[model samples]
Target chain A: MSALFDYTLRLADSALILGHRLSEWIGHAPLLEEELALGNLALDLIGQARALYAYAGAVEGKGRDEDALAYLRDCGQFRNLLLVEQPNGDFAVTIARQLLYSAFAHPFWRDLARSRDATLAAIAAKAEKESAYHLRHAGEWLIRLGDGTAESHRRAQAALDTLWPYVGELFESDAVEEALVNQGIAVDPAALRPEWERSVQAIIAEATLAAPAGTGMQSGGRIGRHSEHLGHLLATMQFLQRAYPGASW
Target chain B: MSAGLRERALAAASGVVDPEIPVLTIADLGVLRAVRLAGDTVEIEITPTYSGCPAMRVIEQELATALRAAGIGKFRIATVLSPAWTTDWLSKEGRRKLAEFGIAPPAGISRRSHFGTDAVACPRCGSAETERISEFGSTACKALYRCRRCAEPFDYFKCH
Candidate 1:
């Protein structure tokens, strides 16, 4: 497989999977305002995924389009980070996961906006703005929940502890990312680590929550190895297309 | 196609109003970016104010219908996501229409991280003493705000 194709698919799959996870909260959010916010955020991610998938399909010179690439791919073929595919445990868990991912995504997309690939740069430029808002939203919630009532603080901290192990995978630079970074087509994930740490730590400090102690890194979403959660997510997400082939709204 | 025909086609397509903010046309909203005509075929390029905006599909359908009604045939509508659409593109006429229709126009260029503490002027009473109720509004492109002066809640077509 082409490195560019793999790299693009990695980005697309992460967005698609995470967007699907967020959409699962559409009607179930803790509050009416949160429902709208999560849904809107999900839409932005899915939109980013759609653009990336379209570009990936074009670059691969495949007959596949966005829908096919999204729905037809099996679990082993998916390249999303394991962090994104994890289930939304509780409101605090969801907030924690989003906080970590968006912190990384903001700078990652910012760097990608300057990519030599025109299409990638354009998508990144747009996505970076959206990711910034998403990070803000998550950060706001982190502070609110952590600094709120005793129960809320405990739950927030618990979620953070559970989700902390996944953060390492985000900054791990593999062969695909290494090659693309050298070619000026991809941002080096390792380089984004410092900024991500500083921003996340600052938010954690304000929230009055202690950062989770570093744990063993669980990696391998870039190579299509994902947690058990992705399988369940794909089953629901791809159900309509699989059940009725070529279905359109 | 003649330049006159192309101009006519562009004028007709420009008349398609944004489905969400009916007070403003796509032209006024700055969503309609370009129109091209070759022979009998026309191509229209539009940018979405927000990435996941549901109004985009409606706008595309309306644009095609408007062009067809004007007797233009073989038209294609393309959505360009680059240089992402900004409220800066909203025309003066669009801002006036938004305020007149009771929706506050965006105050400044949309930034991702900066949720401005700067007060938004109330569209109802022209008071700068407005407070944001929620960052996410009734729609993806808006934020809910209430005027301290008039006590009226309205949607602000957010900078993004």
Candidate 2:
């Protein structure tokens, strides 16, 4: 519908997909400490998702609510980025994805906190703090793996290479960008690219890892289009709500 | 309590502790955001401890029973998911209760902004000799930490 609504849904979808993906690591983290950390982060992401979807529903003024948006929507209607829907692989791969996304998010949301939209800004303010912690955590793992034993280093490098293809889509500016940027309610995703590059480059350098070369991105989540993985994710994440249907215990 | 004093009656419910962390009461944890007396209708705004947290229903039941026991009827506890709950909402007494429960309270409202982090002091030993081995601990509310001086593993209730 409107750009504000689209932007809100996009944010909600990002949190929903990533939150679900992260939850998949509930029992499967490399370390017990990390398991708790990732789960806590997941809780935070899910909380953000609920708040965003609820707000979007409210803003739409058509009485959708969080459940309507989260459970009722089909796969193509979701607007999450591709990286978030990627399955959790090994410790290195998971951390690599976490590192990449958090690396971008650490700055992206920090700047988003300054948005003209008070609610969005408020949400971003809190999210920025949480993301900063997650980035540090993922950064530590990146360093350990990138400089650890031969196999560890190799796996870490490979994770980075595989995840690199999804990085471009995060910075791709689009129609929602035009609406929000024009209304002073958005930050140009492209505008954050320089700073994202500088910070990520430093982290990668510290990890002694090469930036995987890539020219194209697997973009198309922001406009209700997503990868194959998203459908599977939605099936699992939304099953309970779909089945229960108004039985609020 | 007067007919319009239902909220005042519910205010005495400082005994309903968060199920996960049993030491802090619902009131102390600040989850009981508001207990309003709207004529005969009591509307209580509850803030959940976490999203997807299973304890909301439990807390809701506890609240209804507490209100009923306190001679208040026709009460509805509404979940307010906005200004999403933060550790900042935690009362000072709640933090103390957490410490007494063997979980380290947040060092402060400020979160872990970056790495090269130092260990927060141990609640039991009162020594700055603690180490966070894992970011998440037994549950979403805590992080696994160890006290170096005491050589004991404990949970650190993370700042929200």
Candidate 3:
């Protein structure tokens, strides 16, 4: 596969898995409006995934369109970050992951939204706008959960404590970043780490939540290596694709 | 008479406004990703921005009814999962349509976020002095921005 496809698949896979997880909250969210909000964010993620996949398809000139890439891809092929595929866990865990992912993504999309490449830049430009909203929503909830009831606060704090470990993987960079950034095809996540930390700390502070002490980093989610949760997600997501095999609507 | 079906179908589809942003039609939001004349069954592909968006089914039914009222034929509004819809697809014309309806569109800042993209002028007052209030706006799909120059609140359809 071409580097373009790999890079694009990484972006698409991140959103696809995360979006699928968020969709689980459609009717089960804490509040009705929130349920709607999560759904909205999920759609945005799916949309971003689509654009990346479609563009990748177009770039690779693969007969495999966006649907093919999304619905047909096998388990090992997905390259989403580990945090995204992790189960929504408890509300706090969900927010923790949301905060981590969206924090990194907020800046990531902001930069990519203005890409040197028109197609990618255009897609990023669009995704950044949505990411801003997602960050805000998750941030507010983070504050509420951190400050709400004692149980809520305790759970939220614990959630962050566990999730904090995995957060490091998002900023992990290697050859892909080197190649893509040097070529201006991808933005460097390393540069965004400082801002992400500051923003997360500030939000945690305002929520009266102490930032959890960092533990050893749990890395390896971005490069097709993920937490245990992703395989189960693929089993569900790919079921129709695998079962039907080239079935189209 | 047959052409009238196409006209009516579009009008009905126009009635398929966004459930969140009710002022704008599906067409206005560009959520109407594609409309195809696949034989007699008109195939409509909608790329919704939000997952399980409540509006999708409504919009699909709306399109069906709108086209039905126009009286030509059968159509299936399919949700395309891949190449998920992005705000970038929200056209400049669509942005204008949204504003005319009193909703603000995303600032759609330049794709470069490393050094700097040109300042996003206010859609309300064309003021470069605008500031982002929140990355998340009223909807999950947009960001909140305020213009100091105009002192008005507006939404920036997120770049993604």
Judged by TM-score, which candidate is best?
Answer: 1
Interface DockQ of each model: 0.62, 0.41, 0.15
- Residue-by-residue lDDT tens digits, candidate 3, B1-160: 4455555556677667777787777877768877656555667788666543456777777777678776746877777644546666776777887767655665553242321223456777877797765554466666567789989977766555
Candidate 3 chain B: minimum summed lDDT over ten consecutive residues — where? B109-118
Candidate 2 clash pair list: A33-B134, A36-B136, A37-B136
lDDT of 2 by residue, A57-174 (tens): 9889999989899899998888888888888878888889888888888788788888888888867776776787778888888998888899998999999888888999888878
Residue-level lDDT for A199 in candidate 3: 83
- Whose TM-score is higher: candidate 2's or candidate 3's? 2
Q: Report the C-alpha lDDT of model 2 over B106-147, residue by residue, as the tens digit.
A: 776755566765458888888897877877666766777888
Better of 1 and 2 by DockQ: 1
Ranking of all candidate structures by their DockQ, best first:
1, 2, 3
Give Cα distance to truth, residue A24, candidate 2, Å.
2.0
Write down the lDDT of every candidate, Cα atoms only. Answer: 0.89, 0.80, 0.75
Cα lDDT for residue A92, candidate 3? 84
Docking class of 2: acceptable
Worst 10 residues of 3 chain A by lDDT: A219-228
Report how far off residue B110 is in candidate 2 (Å).
1.5
